[model samples]
Target: MRSPAAGVPDPTSAALWGLPLWLWVVLGGIGLFGVFQVYYWVGHRLGSRLYASRLGRRLGQDNIRRVENAVRRWGALAVYGCFWVPGLRHTLPWTAGVLRISYPWYVVASALGCLTWVPVTSFGLYSMIWGWLRLAARSPALAAGVAVVVVAAVAVLVLRRRRRRRREAERRPEDTLTTA
Candidate 1:
């Protein structure tokens, strides 16, 4: 992908930033999802490495004990809230597991933290993505093509869902009105 060299006379970047607000929005979402997926994968790997299990070591056990207390006492909201906090997320899950923190609660709290992370940080990210996508808009036809493809795909999905629902309703027409 040998693109225009640095400081080259490229109009792409300018064009992208000049695109309509809506196109930037769509691209921004796509960019945000990509970034989050990368972050999630890295975070998981970092957690496992830093908080690796050792069949039975005192330090490991102590770390687990501390994690368990935090989770057992505060739950996932606490886990997730501290998710982005260095050292906490990595050790918390491992310790919680060892401490026998309820599996469901662990999942719930972690999910909450992930959910919280997005709204808290996505706005800033979306702006950055918008700027990047704006650069892509230098090629008008390419940008329009992308927009059309996305719209067409969404339309196809919606039509498919509606058709499936209609068929299911026809097959079970009697069930639809049986209120007794």
Candidate 2:
């Protein structure tokens, strides 16, 4: 195999900011694991008072309750599964800590989650971005159209979700009053 030219990067190898892609993935996994530990400890320390904290208020009681239920039901498994989910990824770990799930199990599950999730997301996201960049280089107009379509789809989804939530909220008070 031929060596890359002086000062030139290898086209076949993925590198970012002078670091190999694998290194970045490893670092990212470690960072996420550390953050998850922090979240767990914070939740553990906060205990029952977590529900009254400013962050808790912002997260909303209903949402925290949902997370709490998931943690209670699934235990450490939920911590692993949360890595695949969007909002739950951030919330579930804290709930696990607050509920005082088995620490050894939590570590095992979280480590597995980091190991699987970071590489998949890192490589997948890198490929998507590079693919977009290549498309942009070849056809700027096509790239712009693709970007617009993605943005529009996300906006539409967000608006629909918001509308649905508003309708739910409107009905909640009436339902509560009737039940009372």
Indicate which candidate wins on lDDT. Answer: 2
Error (Å) of candidate 2 at residue 31 is: 0.5
User: For each candidate, how many residue pairs have backbone atoms clashing (under 3 Å)?
Assistant: 4, 0
- Show the lowest summed lDDT stretch of 10 residues, model 2: 171-180
- For model 2, residues 31-147, the per-residue Cα lDDT tens digits are 999999999999899997987777776566777899999999999999999999998998899889899999999999999999999999998898788779878988999999999
Report the C-alpha displacement of residue 115, candidate 2, in angstroms: 0.3
- Overlapping backbone residue pairs in candidate 1 total 4
* Full-model lDDT, candidate 1: 0.55
Reference-based lDDT, residue 90, model 2: 88
Q: What TM-score does each of the candidates earn?
A: 0.35, 0.83
Q: Which stretches of candidate 2 lie over 4 Å from their true place?
A: 1-12, 165-180
Which ranges of candidate 1 are over 4 A from the true structure? 1-65, 125-180
